[model samples]
Target: MSTTAPRQATTPTSTGWSLGDIAVRRVDEIELPRQTGPWLLPDATKEVLDEASWLRPDFADADVPRLASHGFAVTAGGLRIVVDTGIGNGKTRANPAWHGLDTDFLARLAAAGFPPESVDLVITTHLHTDHVGWNTRLAGEDWVPTFSDARYLTSRTEWDHWAAADLDEARRQMFRDSVHPVRDAGQYDRVDVPEQGREVAPGVFLVPAPGHTPGQVAVELRGSDRRALITGDSIHHPVQLSHPHVHSCVDLDPAQAVRTRARLLDTLADTDTLLLGTHFPRPTAGTVRRENGRYRLLAEHGSEIAATAA
Candidate 1:
Protein backbone atom coordinates (compact mmCIF):
# COMPACT_ATOMS: atom_id res chain seq x y z
CA MET A 1 0.00 0.00 0.00
CA SER A 2 1.02 3.59 -0.56
CA THR A 3 1.94 5.78 2.42
CA THR A 4 0.84 9.34 3.30
CA ALA A 5 1.80 11.78 5.98
CA PRO A 6 -0.66 12.71 8.75
CA ARG A 7 -2.50 16.05 8.61
CA GLN A 8 -4.67 18.09 11.00
CA ALA A 9 -8.43 18.38 11.54
CA THR A 10 -10.33 21.09 9.63
CA THR A 11 -14.10 20.55 9.49
CA PRO A 12 -17.11 22.47 8.10
CA THR A 13 -14.75 23.46 5.36
CA SER A 14 -13.92 20.88 2.70
CA THR A 15 -11.93 18.43 4.87
CA GLY A 16 -10.00 15.47 3.55
CA TRP A 17 -8.67 12.38 5.34
CA SER A 18 -5.86 10.11 4.29
CA LEU A 19 -5.47 6.41 4.88
CA GLY A 20 -2.05 5.56 3.51
CA ASP A 21 -2.07 6.87 -0.06
CA ILE A 22 -5.89 6.93 -0.31
CA ALA A 23 -7.32 10.42 0.12
CA VAL A 24 -10.95 10.98 1.11
CA ARG A 25 -12.59 14.40 0.86
CA ARG A 26 -16.02 15.80 1.63
CA VAL A 27 -17.83 17.95 -0.98
CA ASP A 28 -20.49 20.10 0.57
CA GLU A 29 -23.98 20.73 -0.83
CA ILE A 30 -26.10 22.14 2.03
CA GLU A 31 -26.07 22.14 5.80
CA LEU A 32 -29.24 23.17 7.64
CA PRO A 33 -31.32 22.48 10.70
CA ARG A 34 -33.87 19.69 10.48
CA GLN A 35 -36.91 19.37 12.70
CA THR A 36 -36.71 16.85 15.45
CA GLY A 37 -40.35 15.98 15.20
CA PRO A 38 -40.96 13.25 12.59
CA TRP A 39 -37.77 14.24 10.81
CA LEU A 40 -34.63 13.30 12.75
CA LEU A 41 -34.83 11.14 15.83
CA PRO A 42 -38.45 11.67 16.85
CA ASP A 43 -37.55 11.00 20.48
CA ALA A 44 -34.69 13.53 20.32
CA THR A 45 -36.55 16.33 22.04
CA LYS A 46 -35.14 19.29 23.99
CA GLU A 47 -34.59 16.99 26.93
CA VAL A 48 -32.57 14.55 24.87
CA LEU A 49 -30.54 17.27 23.20
CA ASP A 50 -29.78 18.84 26.55
CA GLU A 51 -28.67 15.49 27.86
CA ALA A 52 -26.27 15.12 24.99
CA SER A 53 -24.43 18.34 25.67
CA TRP A 54 -21.68 17.55 23.21
CA LEU A 55 -24.08 18.00 20.28
CA ARG A 56 -24.54 21.72 20.88
CA PRO A 57 -23.79 24.40 18.24
CA ASP A 58 -22.38 22.07 15.63
CA PHE A 59 -24.64 19.05 15.30
CA ALA A 60 -27.63 20.68 17.06
CA ASP A 61 -28.64 24.01 18.47
CA ALA A 62 -31.27 25.29 20.95
CA ASP A 63 -34.03 24.43 18.50
CA VAL A 64 -33.50 21.50 16.13
CA PRO A 65 -30.67 19.18 15.14
CA ARG A 66 -28.72 19.89 11.96
CA LEU A 67 -27.51 17.57 9.19
CA ALA A 68 -25.64 18.05 5.94
CA SER A 69 -26.08 16.67 2.45
CA HIS A 70 -22.70 16.16 0.85
CA GLY A 71 -20.60 13.81 -1.29
CA PHE A 72 -17.40 12.03 -0.29
CA ALA A 73 -14.59 11.73 -2.82
CA VAL A 74 -12.09 8.90 -2.34
CA THR A 75 -8.95 8.82 -4.45
CA ALA A 76 -6.98 5.62 -4.32
CA GLY A 77 -5.55 2.82 -6.45
CA GLY A 78 -5.39 5.07 -9.53
CA LEU A 79 -9.13 5.80 -9.35
CA ARG A 80 -11.35 8.62 -8.17
CA ILE A 81 -14.29 7.04 -6.32
CA VAL A 82 -17.20 9.13 -5.07
CA VAL A 83 -19.59 7.95 -2.40
CA ASP A 84 -23.20 9.22 -2.08
CA THR A 85 -23.90 12.05 -4.51
CA GLY A 86 -25.79 14.77 -2.69
CA ILE A 87 -28.97 16.47 -3.95
CA GLY A 88 -28.36 17.71 -7.44
CA ASN A 89 -29.64 20.79 -9.25
CA GLY A 90 -33.18 21.08 -10.65
CA LYS A 91 -34.77 18.01 -9.15
CA THR A 92 -38.28 17.69 -7.76
CA ARG A 93 -38.10 16.31 -4.24
CA ALA A 94 -40.86 15.44 -1.82
CA ASN A 95 -39.15 17.66 0.77
CA PRO A 96 -39.24 21.35 -0.14
CA ALA A 97 -35.69 21.84 1.14
CA TRP A 98 -34.34 19.40 -1.46
CA HIS A 99 -36.42 20.58 -4.41
CA GLY A 100 -34.77 22.45 -7.26
CA LEU A 101 -31.45 22.65 -5.47
CA ASP A 102 -29.17 24.84 -7.57
CA THR A 103 -26.01 24.58 -5.50
CA ASP A 104 -22.35 24.84 -6.52
CA PHE A 105 -21.80 21.17 -5.79
CA LEU A 106 -20.16 20.46 -9.15
CA ALA A 107 -17.92 23.47 -8.85
CA ARG A 108 -16.92 22.38 -5.36
CA LEU A 109 -16.08 18.92 -6.66
CA ALA A 110 -13.94 20.46 -9.35
CA ALA A 111 -12.24 22.71 -6.80
CA ALA A 112 -11.27 19.56 -4.94
CA GLY A 113 -9.45 18.38 -8.10
CA PHE A 114 -11.94 15.68 -9.05
CA PRO A 115 -14.14 16.88 -11.87
CA PRO A 116 -17.20 14.99 -13.10
CA GLU A 117 -15.43 13.19 -15.92
CA SER A 118 -12.42 12.42 -13.74
CA VAL A 119 -14.43 10.20 -11.48
CA ASP A 120 -13.82 6.47 -11.99
CA LEU A 121 -16.46 4.99 -9.68
CA VAL A 122 -19.65 6.36 -8.08
CA ILE A 123 -21.18 4.39 -5.21
CA THR A 124 -24.50 5.12 -3.58
CA THR A 125 -24.64 3.45 -0.18
CA HIS A 126 -28.40 3.24 -0.50
CA LEU A 127 -31.07 4.56 -2.89
CA HIS A 128 -32.07 7.53 -0.75
CA THR A 129 -33.10 10.74 -2.49
CA ASP A 130 -30.18 12.74 -1.11
CA HIS A 131 -27.68 9.95 -1.69
CA VAL A 132 -28.34 9.45 -5.41
CA GLY A 133 -29.44 12.88 -6.70
CA TRP A 134 -26.14 13.80 -8.30
CA ASN A 135 -25.89 10.51 -10.15
CA THR A 136 -27.15 12.48 -13.14
CA ARG A 137 -27.48 16.09 -14.15
CA LEU A 138 -30.02 17.97 -16.28
CA ALA A 139 -29.10 18.39 -19.92
CA GLY A 140 -31.00 20.42 -22.54
CA GLU A 141 -34.05 18.19 -22.29
CA ASP A 142 -33.02 14.99 -20.55
CA TRP A 143 -31.15 13.73 -17.51
CA VAL A 144 -27.73 12.26 -18.25
CA PRO A 145 -25.02 10.52 -16.25
CA THR A 146 -22.98 13.17 -14.51
CA PHE A 147 -19.81 11.07 -14.36
CA SER A 148 -19.57 10.26 -18.06
CA ASP A 149 -16.48 8.04 -17.66
CA ALA A 150 -17.36 6.38 -14.35
CA ARG A 151 -19.25 3.22 -13.50
CA TYR A 152 -22.02 3.86 -10.98
CA LEU A 153 -22.36 1.19 -8.29
CA THR A 154 -25.62 0.65 -6.45
CA SER A 155 -26.41 -2.13 -4.03
CA ARG A 156 -28.34 -4.84 -5.87
CA THR A 157 -30.90 -5.18 -3.07
CA GLU A 158 -31.33 -1.41 -2.83
CA TRP A 159 -32.03 -1.12 -6.53
CA ASP A 160 -34.64 -3.89 -6.41
CA HIS A 161 -36.28 -2.49 -3.26
CA TRP A 162 -36.67 1.04 -4.58
CA ALA A 163 -37.78 -0.19 -7.99
CA ALA A 164 -40.67 -2.14 -6.49
CA ALA A 165 -41.32 0.08 -3.50
CA ASP A 166 -44.82 1.60 -3.22
CA LEU A 167 -43.39 5.07 -3.66
CA ASP A 168 -45.31 8.15 -4.70
CA GLU A 169 -44.88 9.98 -7.99
CA ALA A 170 -42.19 12.26 -6.59
CA ARG A 171 -39.88 9.36 -5.53
CA ARG A 172 -40.62 7.47 -8.74
CA GLN A 173 -39.42 10.53 -10.57
CA MET A 174 -36.16 10.27 -8.63
CA PHE A 175 -35.46 6.77 -9.98
CA ARG A 176 -36.44 7.73 -13.49
CA ASP A 177 -34.19 10.76 -13.63
CA SER A 178 -31.16 10.03 -11.46
CA VAL A 179 -31.02 6.21 -11.56
CA HIS A 180 -32.41 4.97 -14.87
CA PRO A 181 -30.36 7.28 -17.04
CA VAL A 182 -27.08 5.72 -15.92
CA ARG A 183 -28.43 2.17 -16.26
CA ASP A 184 -29.60 2.98 -19.76
CA ALA A 185 -26.10 4.17 -20.59
CA GLY A 186 -24.74 0.83 -19.38
CA GLN A 187 -22.68 2.68 -16.77
CA TYR A 188 -24.21 1.04 -13.73
CA ASP A 189 -22.87 -1.90 -11.65
CA ARG A 190 -24.96 -3.77 -9.10
CA VAL A 191 -22.95 -4.83 -6.01
CA ASP A 192 -24.00 -7.69 -3.79
CA VAL A 193 -21.72 -7.71 -0.73
CA PRO A 194 -21.64 -10.15 2.12
CA GLU A 195 -21.99 -9.07 5.75
CA GLN A 196 -18.28 -9.68 6.21
CA GLY A 197 -17.53 -7.01 3.59
CA ARG A 198 -16.61 -7.11 -0.12
CA GLU A 199 -13.47 -5.52 -1.50
CA VAL A 200 -14.33 -3.15 -4.33
CA ALA A 201 -10.92 -1.52 -4.81
CA PRO A 202 -7.29 -2.00 -3.80
CA GLY A 203 -7.74 -1.05 -0.14
CA VAL A 204 -11.45 -0.26 -0.04
CA PHE A 205 -14.45 -2.47 0.68
CA LEU A 206 -18.20 -2.36 1.40
CA VAL A 207 -19.35 -3.37 4.86
CA PRO A 208 -22.97 -4.44 5.13
CA ALA A 209 -24.81 -2.03 7.42
CA PRO A 210 -28.51 -2.42 6.84
CA GLY A 211 -31.74 -1.06 8.38
CA HIS A 212 -31.12 2.67 7.87
CA THR A 213 -32.13 1.46 4.45
CA PRO A 214 -32.61 -2.25 3.82
CA GLY A 215 -29.43 -2.41 1.72
CA GLN A 216 -27.38 0.39 3.26
CA VAL A 217 -23.61 -0.35 3.41
CA ALA A 218 -20.67 1.48 4.92
CA VAL A 219 -17.54 2.03 2.84
CA GLU A 220 -14.36 0.91 4.57
CA LEU A 221 -10.82 1.98 3.67
CA ARG A 222 -7.75 0.22 4.98
CA GLY A 223 -4.14 1.14 4.59
CA SER A 224 -1.03 -0.63 5.85
CA ASP A 225 -1.69 0.43 9.47
CA ARG A 226 -4.70 2.82 9.34
CA ARG A 227 -8.40 2.29 8.70
CA ALA A 228 -11.62 4.31 8.31
CA LEU A 229 -15.29 3.73 7.65
CA ILE A 230 -17.63 6.08 5.77
CA THR A 231 -20.87 5.57 7.66
CA GLY A 232 -23.66 6.08 5.11
CA ASP A 233 -26.64 7.15 7.21
CA SER A 234 -26.14 4.16 9.48
CA ILE A 235 -25.60 6.58 12.38
CA HIS A 236 -26.87 10.03 11.40
CA HIS A 237 -25.49 12.19 14.20
CA PRO A 238 -22.89 11.96 16.95
CA VAL A 239 -25.67 11.78 19.49
CA GLN A 240 -26.31 8.32 18.11
CA LEU A 241 -22.77 7.52 19.19
CA SER A 242 -23.88 8.09 22.78
CA HIS A 243 -27.35 6.73 22.21
CA PRO A 244 -27.18 4.09 19.53
CA HIS A 245 -30.84 3.20 19.98
CA VAL A 246 -32.06 6.62 18.83
CA HIS A 247 -33.29 5.79 15.35
CA SER A 248 -33.76 8.43 12.68
CA CYS A 249 -37.22 9.17 11.32
CA VAL A 250 -36.07 8.16 7.87
CA ASP A 251 -35.04 4.68 8.95
CA LEU A 252 -36.90 1.93 7.11
CA ASP A 253 -36.67 -0.42 10.09
CA PRO A 254 -36.11 1.33 13.39
CA ALA A 255 -35.48 -1.82 15.37
CA GLN A 256 -33.03 -3.16 12.84
CA ALA A 257 -31.28 0.18 12.56
CA VAL A 258 -30.64 0.17 16.27
CA ARG A 259 -29.15 -3.29 16.06
CA THR A 260 -26.87 -2.35 13.20
CA ARG A 261 -25.75 0.83 14.91
CA ALA A 262 -24.92 -1.02 18.09
CA ARG A 263 -23.09 -3.73 16.24
CA LEU A 264 -21.00 -1.27 14.22
CA LEU A 265 -20.15 0.75 17.27
CA ASP A 266 -19.22 -2.32 19.22
CA THR A 267 -16.97 -3.57 16.47
CA LEU A 268 -15.12 -0.26 16.10
CA ALA A 269 -14.95 0.79 19.73
CA ASP A 270 -11.39 1.06 21.11
CA THR A 271 -10.04 0.07 17.72
CA ASP A 272 -7.97 2.32 15.48
CA THR A 273 -10.80 2.58 12.98
CA LEU A 274 -11.70 6.19 12.16
CA LEU A 275 -15.42 6.90 11.95
CA LEU A 276 -16.50 9.24 9.16
CA GLY A 277 -20.16 10.08 9.45
CA THR A 278 -21.90 11.10 6.20
CA HIS A 279 -24.36 13.55 7.81
CA PHE A 280 -22.12 14.69 10.68
CA PRO A 281 -21.46 18.41 10.75
CA ARG A 282 -18.05 20.10 11.24
CA PRO A 283 -15.24 17.88 12.53
CA THR A 284 -17.05 15.04 10.77
CA ALA A 285 -14.33 12.38 11.14
CA GLY A 286 -13.58 10.72 14.44
CA THR A 287 -12.99 7.47 16.28
CA VAL A 288 -15.29 5.45 18.55
CA ARG A 289 -14.36 5.04 22.20
CA ARG A 290 -16.08 2.85 24.75
CA GLU A 291 -16.57 5.15 27.71
CA ASN A 292 -18.17 3.85 30.87
CA GLY A 293 -19.94 1.09 28.96
CA ARG A 294 -21.26 3.54 26.31
CA TYR A 295 -19.77 4.71 23.05
CA ARG A 296 -18.60 8.28 22.35
CA LEU A 297 -17.17 9.78 19.16
CA LEU A 298 -13.66 11.17 19.72
CA ALA A 299 -13.55 13.95 17.15
CA GLU A 300 -10.30 14.39 15.26
CA HIS A 301 -8.43 17.47 16.50
CA GLY A 302 -4.89 17.13 15.18
CA SER A 303 -4.33 14.75 18.04
CA GLU A 304 -5.67 11.48 16.64
CA ILE A 305 -3.46 9.21 14.58
CA ALA A 306 -5.59 9.74 11.46
CA ALA A 307 -5.05 12.86 9.32
CA THR A 308 -7.75 14.98 7.54
CA ALA A 309 -7.52 17.73 4.90
CA ALA A 310 -9.86 19.44 2.38
Candidate 2:
Protein backbone atom coordinates (compact mmCIF):
# COMPACT_ATOMS: atom_id res chain seq x y z
CA MET A 1 0.00 0.00 0.00
CA SER A 2 1.06 3.62 -0.46
CA THR A 3 1.08 3.95 3.30
CA THR A 4 -0.41 2.15 6.21
CA ALA A 5 -3.69 3.09 7.95
CA PRO A 6 -6.37 5.52 6.76
CA ARG A 7 -7.36 9.02 7.62
CA GLN A 8 -10.61 9.94 9.37
CA ALA A 9 -13.58 10.25 7.01
CA THR A 10 -13.84 14.03 7.28
CA THR A 11 -16.76 14.61 4.93
CA PRO A 12 -19.89 12.48 5.13
CA THR A 13 -21.77 13.51 1.99
CA SER A 14 -20.29 11.21 -0.65
CA THR A 15 -21.63 8.88 -3.36
CA GLY A 16 -20.89 5.15 -3.45
CA TRP A 17 -19.93 2.59 -6.11
CA SER A 18 -20.67 -1.12 -6.75
CA LEU A 19 -18.82 -2.89 -9.54
CA GLY A 20 -19.01 -6.53 -10.58
CA ASP A 21 -21.88 -6.59 -8.06
CA ILE A 22 -19.38 -5.97 -5.25
CA ALA A 23 -19.80 -2.81 -3.20
CA VAL A 24 -16.66 -0.66 -2.77
CA ARG A 25 -15.97 2.04 -0.22
CA ARG A 26 -14.65 5.44 -1.05
CA VAL A 27 -10.94 5.64 -0.20
CA ASP A 28 -11.46 8.97 1.61
CA GLU A 29 -9.91 12.34 0.72
CA ILE A 30 -6.44 13.85 0.52
CA GLU A 31 -5.39 17.46 1.15
CA LEU A 32 -4.09 18.75 -2.14
CA PRO A 33 -3.29 22.31 -3.31
CA ARG A 34 -5.94 24.11 -5.39
CA GLN A 35 -6.43 27.61 -6.65
CA THR A 36 -9.50 29.27 -5.34
CA GLY A 37 -8.50 31.84 -7.88
CA PRO A 38 -11.32 34.10 -8.98
CA TRP A 39 -14.63 32.99 -7.53
CA LEU A 40 -15.88 32.32 -11.09
CA LEU A 41 -14.22 32.32 -14.47
CA PRO A 42 -12.82 35.73 -15.44
CA ASP A 43 -14.24 35.47 -18.92
CA ALA A 44 -17.52 34.70 -17.26
CA THR A 45 -18.32 37.86 -15.35
CA LYS A 46 -21.51 37.73 -13.31
CA GLU A 47 -23.40 39.39 -10.44
CA VAL A 48 -25.09 38.07 -7.28
CA LEU A 49 -28.28 37.21 -9.18
CA ASP A 50 -26.34 35.39 -11.88
CA GLU A 51 -24.14 33.63 -9.34
CA ALA A 52 -27.12 32.41 -7.39
CA SER A 53 -29.16 31.41 -10.41
CA TRP A 54 -26.28 29.93 -12.31
CA LEU A 55 -24.63 27.01 -10.51
CA ARG A 56 -21.74 29.23 -9.45
CA PRO A 57 -20.24 30.20 -6.11
CA ASP A 58 -18.75 33.35 -4.63
CA PHE A 59 -15.02 33.56 -4.05
CA ALA A 60 -15.51 32.75 -0.41
CA ASP A 61 -13.88 29.84 1.38
CA ALA A 62 -14.02 27.43 -1.51
CA ASP A 63 -12.94 24.12 0.04
CA VAL A 64 -12.92 21.80 -2.93
CA PRO A 65 -13.92 18.18 -2.06
CA ARG A 66 -10.73 16.91 -0.41
CA LEU A 67 -12.32 14.25 1.72
CA ALA A 68 -15.18 14.24 -0.72
CA SER A 69 -12.89 13.10 -3.53
CA HIS A 70 -12.48 9.33 -3.70
CA GLY A 71 -10.60 6.69 -5.69
CA PHE A 72 -12.47 3.50 -6.59
CA ALA A 73 -10.56 0.21 -6.84
CA VAL A 74 -12.60 -2.10 -9.05
CA THR A 75 -12.17 -5.52 -10.60
CA ALA A 76 -12.11 -5.23 -14.40
CA GLY A 77 -11.16 -7.81 -17.00
CA GLY A 78 -9.61 -9.95 -14.28
CA LEU A 79 -7.28 -7.08 -13.37
CA ARG A 80 -7.40 -4.74 -10.44
CA ILE A 81 -7.40 -1.36 -12.11
CA VAL A 82 -7.07 2.03 -10.46
CA VAL A 83 -8.83 4.55 -12.72
CA ASP A 84 -7.31 7.88 -11.71
CA THR A 85 -4.68 8.92 -9.15
CA GLY A 86 -5.65 12.03 -7.22
CA ILE A 87 -3.08 14.66 -6.24
CA GLY A 88 0.19 13.33 -4.83
CA ASN A 89 2.45 14.74 -2.17
CA GLY A 90 5.66 16.80 -2.55
CA LYS A 91 4.82 18.10 -6.02
CA THR A 92 6.06 21.59 -6.84
CA ARG A 93 4.13 24.05 -9.01
CA ALA A 94 4.29 27.81 -9.69
CA ASN A 95 0.68 28.97 -9.52
CA PRO A 96 -0.60 30.03 -6.14
CA ALA A 97 -3.62 27.95 -7.06
CA TRP A 98 -1.22 24.98 -7.07
CA HIS A 99 2.14 25.24 -5.37
CA GLY A 100 4.30 23.19 -3.06
CA LEU A 101 2.01 20.96 -1.08
CA ASP A 102 1.57 17.31 -0.20
CA THR A 103 -1.58 15.23 -0.42
CA ASP A 104 -2.57 11.84 1.04
CA PHE A 105 -3.34 10.29 -2.36
CA LEU A 106 -1.06 7.32 -1.71
CA ALA A 107 -2.25 7.04 1.85
CA ARG A 108 -5.85 7.10 0.70
CA LEU A 109 -5.02 4.58 -2.02
CA ALA A 110 -3.68 2.42 0.80
CA ALA A 111 -6.73 3.20 2.89
CA ALA A 112 -8.71 1.73 -0.01
CA GLY A 113 -6.59 -1.46 0.24
CA PHE A 114 -4.29 -0.75 -2.71
CA PRO A 115 -0.53 -0.59 -2.60
CA PRO A 116 1.24 1.58 -5.13
CA GLU A 117 2.39 -1.68 -6.68
CA SER A 118 -1.03 -3.31 -6.61
CA VAL A 119 -2.50 -1.32 -9.49
CA ASP A 120 -2.24 -3.36 -12.70
CA LEU A 121 -3.10 -0.39 -14.88
CA VAL A 122 -3.40 3.36 -14.23
CA ILE A 123 -5.69 5.10 -16.72
CA THR A 124 -5.53 8.85 -16.98
CA THR A 125 -8.78 10.21 -18.42
CA HIS A 126 -6.98 13.41 -19.25
CA LEU A 127 -3.92 15.53 -18.48
CA HIS A 128 -4.80 18.10 -15.89
CA THR A 129 -3.09 19.14 -12.65
CA ASP A 130 -5.33 17.25 -10.24
CA HIS A 131 -6.15 14.39 -12.60
CA VAL A 132 -2.52 13.40 -13.15
CA GLY A 133 -0.92 14.82 -10.04
CA TRP A 134 0.05 11.43 -8.69
CA ASN A 135 1.40 10.08 -11.96
CA THR A 136 4.86 10.55 -10.49
CA ARG A 137 5.91 10.89 -6.88
CA LEU A 138 8.81 12.79 -5.40
CA ALA A 139 11.70 10.41 -4.76
CA GLY A 140 14.98 11.81 -3.45
CA GLU A 141 16.39 14.17 -6.10
CA ASP A 142 14.08 13.20 -8.96
CA TRP A 143 10.45 12.27 -9.40
CA VAL A 144 9.61 8.59 -9.94
CA PRO A 145 6.63 6.82 -11.45
CA THR A 146 4.07 6.34 -8.69
CA PHE A 147 3.04 2.80 -9.65
CA SER A 148 6.19 0.84 -10.43
CA ASP A 149 4.46 -2.30 -11.71
CA ALA A 150 1.50 -0.67 -13.45
CA ARG A 151 1.30 0.34 -17.05
CA TYR A 152 0.42 4.06 -17.13
CA LEU A 153 -2.03 4.73 -19.96
CA THR A 154 -2.35 8.14 -21.59
CA SER A 155 -3.38 9.27 -25.09
CA ARG A 156 -0.50 9.78 -27.52
CA THR A 157 -1.91 13.16 -28.56
CA GLU A 158 -2.21 14.45 -24.99
CA TRP A 159 1.42 13.50 -24.28
CA ASP A 160 2.55 15.58 -27.24
CA HIS A 161 0.66 18.87 -26.70
CA TRP A 162 1.73 19.33 -23.09
CA ALA A 163 5.30 18.21 -23.73
CA ALA A 164 5.84 20.91 -26.31
CA ALA A 165 8.44 23.49 -25.21
CA ASP A 166 6.66 26.48 -26.71
CA LEU A 167 3.64 26.00 -24.47
CA ASP A 168 3.23 28.19 -21.35
CA GLU A 169 5.26 27.47 -18.23
CA ALA A 170 2.39 25.96 -16.30
CA ARG A 171 1.59 23.52 -19.10
CA ARG A 172 5.27 22.72 -19.70
CA GLN A 173 6.09 22.05 -16.05
CA MET A 174 2.98 19.95 -15.57
CA PHE A 175 4.24 17.63 -18.29
CA ARG A 176 7.84 17.69 -17.07
CA ASP A 177 7.32 17.09 -13.35
CA SER A 178 4.13 15.07 -13.51
CA VAL A 179 4.12 13.11 -16.78
CA HIS A 180 7.60 12.70 -18.29
CA PRO A 181 9.01 10.62 -15.43
CA VAL A 182 6.55 7.82 -16.22
CA ARG A 183 7.53 8.00 -19.88
CA ASP A 184 11.20 8.06 -18.96
CA ALA A 185 10.72 4.83 -17.01
CA GLY A 186 9.44 3.09 -20.17
CA GLN A 187 6.35 2.05 -18.21
CA TYR A 188 4.20 4.40 -20.27
CA ASP A 189 1.99 3.04 -23.06
CA ARG A 190 0.67 5.62 -25.52
CA VAL A 191 -2.78 4.23 -26.20
CA ASP A 192 -3.98 5.75 -29.48
CA VAL A 193 -7.68 5.14 -29.11
CA PRO A 194 -8.44 6.19 -32.68
CA GLU A 195 -12.11 5.35 -33.24
CA GLN A 196 -13.18 1.87 -32.17
CA GLY A 197 -12.62 2.86 -28.54
CA ARG A 198 -10.09 0.32 -27.31
CA GLU A 199 -11.22 -1.85 -24.44
CA VAL A 200 -8.36 -1.64 -21.95
CA ALA A 201 -10.11 -4.23 -19.85
CA PRO A 202 -13.15 -6.47 -20.28
CA GLY A 203 -15.78 -3.91 -19.42
CA VAL A 204 -13.55 -0.86 -19.00
CA PHE A 205 -13.15 0.92 -22.33
CA LEU A 206 -11.80 4.33 -23.32
CA VAL A 207 -14.33 6.43 -25.23
CA PRO A 208 -12.74 9.16 -27.33
CA ALA A 209 -14.75 12.05 -25.96
CA PRO A 210 -12.27 14.72 -27.01
CA GLY A 211 -12.65 18.54 -27.25
CA HIS A 212 -11.90 19.65 -23.68
CA THR A 213 -8.42 18.62 -24.71
CA PRO A 214 -7.17 17.20 -27.97
CA GLY A 215 -7.24 13.59 -26.84
CA GLN A 216 -9.30 13.74 -23.66
CA VAL A 217 -11.49 10.69 -23.02
CA ALA A 218 -14.40 9.58 -20.90
CA VAL A 219 -13.86 6.06 -19.53
CA GLU A 220 -16.80 3.68 -19.85
CA LEU A 221 -17.26 0.76 -17.46
CA ARG A 222 -19.95 -1.85 -17.99
CA GLY A 223 -20.55 -4.99 -16.01
CA SER A 224 -23.36 -7.49 -15.60
CA ASP A 225 -26.01 -5.01 -14.51
CA ARG A 226 -24.19 -1.69 -14.20
CA ARG A 227 -22.28 0.81 -16.35
CA ALA A 228 -20.55 4.14 -15.70
CA LEU A 229 -18.16 6.76 -17.08
CA ILE A 230 -15.09 8.41 -15.58
CA THR A 231 -15.35 11.87 -17.11
CA GLY A 232 -11.96 13.57 -17.01
CA ASP A 233 -12.88 17.24 -17.42
CA SER A 234 -15.53 17.30 -20.12
CA ILE A 235 -17.70 19.01 -17.57
CA HIS A 236 -16.27 20.93 -14.67
CA HIS A 237 -18.51 22.66 -12.15
CA PRO A 238 -21.80 20.83 -12.66
CA VAL A 239 -23.44 24.03 -13.84
CA GLN A 240 -22.38 23.03 -17.34
CA LEU A 241 -24.88 20.20 -17.28
CA SER A 242 -27.70 22.77 -17.40
CA HIS A 243 -25.84 25.62 -18.99
CA PRO A 244 -23.72 23.96 -21.67
CA HIS A 245 -22.56 27.36 -22.88
CA VAL A 246 -20.47 28.00 -19.78
CA HIS A 247 -17.06 26.91 -20.96
CA SER A 248 -13.98 27.24 -18.80
CA CYS A 249 -11.70 29.92 -20.22
CA VAL A 250 -8.83 27.44 -20.16
CA ASP A 251 -10.54 25.14 -22.63
CA LEU A 252 -8.39 24.47 -25.68
CA ASP A 253 -11.38 24.79 -27.96
CA PRO A 254 -14.34 26.27 -26.18
CA ALA A 255 -16.68 25.67 -29.12
CA GLN A 256 -15.62 22.07 -29.49
CA ALA A 257 -15.77 21.63 -25.76
CA VAL A 258 -19.34 22.84 -25.86
CA ARG A 259 -20.24 20.42 -28.61
CA THR A 260 -18.66 17.51 -26.77
CA ARG A 261 -20.35 18.45 -23.50
CA ALA A 262 -23.70 18.62 -25.23
CA ARG A 263 -23.21 15.23 -26.85
CA LEU A 264 -22.13 13.59 -23.56
CA LEU A 265 -24.92 15.22 -21.62
CA ASP A 266 -27.37 13.83 -24.15
CA THR A 267 -25.74 10.40 -24.26
CA LEU A 268 -26.02 9.82 -20.49
CA ALA A 269 -29.22 11.69 -19.84
CA ASP A 270 -32.12 9.57 -18.56
CA THR A 271 -29.97 6.45 -18.59
CA ASP A 272 -28.89 4.16 -15.76
CA THR A 273 -25.30 5.20 -16.45
CA LEU A 274 -23.26 6.68 -13.60
CA LEU A 275 -20.73 9.44 -14.24
CA LEU A 276 -17.58 9.50 -12.13
CA GLY A 277 -16.56 13.09 -12.68
CA THR A 278 -13.10 14.27 -11.70
CA HIS A 279 -14.53 17.37 -9.96
CA PHE A 280 -18.19 16.73 -9.20
CA PRO A 281 -18.51 17.16 -5.41
CA ARG A 282 -16.56 13.91 -4.76
CA PRO A 283 -17.15 10.25 -4.43
CA THR A 284 -17.18 12.28 -7.62
CA ALA A 285 -19.79 10.07 -9.25
CA GLY A 286 -23.37 10.76 -10.29
CA THR A 287 -26.04 10.25 -12.94
CA VAL A 288 -27.39 12.75 -15.50
CA ARG A 289 -31.05 13.21 -16.44
CA ARG A 290 -32.89 15.67 -18.65
CA GLU A 291 -35.76 17.68 -17.25
CA ASN A 292 -37.02 20.31 -19.71
CA GLY A 293 -34.00 20.62 -22.01
CA ARG A 294 -31.18 20.76 -19.44
CA TYR A 295 -29.79 18.15 -17.08
CA ARG A 296 -28.93 17.73 -13.40
CA LEU A 297 -26.73 15.37 -11.40
CA LEU A 298 -28.32 12.69 -9.27
CA ALA A 299 -26.60 10.33 -6.87
CA GLU A 300 -25.86 6.96 -8.45
CA HIS A 301 -28.50 5.18 -6.41
CA GLY A 302 -30.90 8.08 -6.43
CA SER A 303 -31.13 7.72 -10.18
CA GLU A 304 -31.98 4.06 -9.74
CA ILE A 305 -34.92 5.01 -7.51
CA ALA A 306 -36.06 7.73 -9.88
CA ALA A 307 -35.93 5.28 -12.75
CA THR A 308 -37.84 2.48 -11.05
CA ALA A 309 -40.25 4.57 -8.98
CA ALA A 310 -41.29 6.37 -12.16
In model 1, state the lDDT of residue 296.
Answer: 78
Candidate 1 versus truth, CA RMSD in Å, comes to 6.9
lDDT of each: 0.80, 0.63
- Top lDDT hit: 1
Off by more than 4 A, model 2: 1-15, 21-72, 301-310
RMSD of 2: 6.9
Error (Å) of candidate 1 at residue 189 is 0.8
> What tens-digit string does per-residue lDDT give for candidate 1 at 1-310?
0122112122333467767777788787776435423266677767777776777776777856667777888877888889999778899876766777777888778767778988889988998888899999989999999999998887788778877789888888898999999999999998998878898888989988899888889999886668899999898888888778888877999999999999999989999888988888767778898887778777873222222222
Once fitted onto the true fold, the runs of candidate 1 whose alpha carbons sit more than 4 angstroms away are 1-13, 34-38, 301-310
Worst 10 residues of 1 by lDDT: 1-10
Candidate 1 global lDDT: 0.80
